[model samples]
Target: MVAAYQKLCPETLDGACRELADRDPALDRIYRERGCPPLWQRRPGFRTLVQIILEQQVSLASGRATMKRVENAIGRVTAQSLAGAGESGLRAAGVTRQKALYCTLLARAAMDGELNLGRIARVRDHEALDMLTAFKGVGRWTAEVYLLMALRRPDVWPAGDLALAKALQAVKKLPVKPGEDVMRTIARPWRPFRAVAARMLWQEYLCRNRAASAASG
Candidate 1:
């Protein structure tokens, strides 16, 4: 349950990274050997959330391509533009039918003043997740992603993320990818600093992947 005002900045994230390392020696070794993770913060707003929605179950490159085209088509990603763009136009913008439907629902909600992101930020994490997910297209993973990066909630661990799960598996040397329950149990020790640990693991995941790619090349 993260309070809005208790968001993590770069300085706080640095302290949190150290705190996490101290709690887990293996994670500590990563931190000591590799550099610290970035404070992955996003501005809380409609456009950002919309971008996140476009990113669902897709590669970042794919998501960005779609988002850029959509933004170009609409000139903006506001409720008015989205609602006015219509389904065909959105499809022309490179989004799937499912995503267009999702965009429509989100836009209507936003325009109707149904989704109060700012107020929700002040509430508990579950409450915030609930409020966001109550709308169409937003799920637990999406909601948690918003909480972790957009709202900068300290304790959120989006276990549903494949990247994070894979990273955790590789870092912990698990035989197989852990399920949500297993991920939760493994993440329990990180507690309030789970987001920080997640950031570190994500960085390590990318670093190792890049090295592997380079070696293969």
Candidate 2:
């Protein structure tokens, strides 16, 4: 059963990309131009969850910087360390007050044994998502990202991700970014490999934007 939905490693990652490219021309173009996307997997643990929470509604770089500050402030980014830091320490470490509260609540949940990150890994994707979203700060986007990146679930699609919207627009050559429902519709053909499709779009988004930035600068 564990093998039924195994995490995607490098070999499987490339396979998924090939399969997805066969289905979508835009994704095919991404493979032709950018090569295979990185697995971008994260460790399934409290620290990574905290990092995802920091990423909420913020740029990925900003989220990473804040997470680094959190690590600097409290050494290891454990539930215990974050709990000790509390909201004030987190805010001092460059976390916004709202996010600090969210992190504090998450830390409390983990420390109290309410959230079992290990147990979550053994469960199905929907169950894992439900377990994670049970926490205060872990919304659908956060939970789905954790599933995609940390759990390495092959099929998970994160709805309402701004980067994804932008990437979809750029790749599909739409006049504007897609809305959530439209994104859902657009993503349907990539079923069971939507996560790989997402990786491709993200690559397109980042590389295209970076090139545009360089040209302008």
lDDT against the true structure, per candidate, is: 0.87, 0.89
* Candidate 1 RMSD to the real structure: 2.1
The lowest-lDDT stretch of 10 consecutive residues in candidate 2 is 1-10
Q: Which portions of model 2 miss their true places by more than 4 Å?
A: 1-4
Top lDDT model:
2
- lDDT (tens digit, per residue) of candidate 2 on 1-217: 1132668888888888888888889899999999999898999898999999999999999999999988999999998999999999998999999999999999898889998999999988889999988888889999999999999998889968999999999889999879989999999998788888888888888898999999999
Candidate 1 residue lDDT tens string, 139-197: 88888988999998988989888888888898889999999999899999988888888
Candidate 1: give the clashing pairs: none
Against the true structure, candidate 1 reaches a TM-score of: 0.95
**What value of lDDT does candidate 1 attain over all alpha carbons?**
0.87
**Residue-pair clashes per candidate:** 0, 0
**Residue 93 CA displacement from its true place in model 1, Å:** 0.6
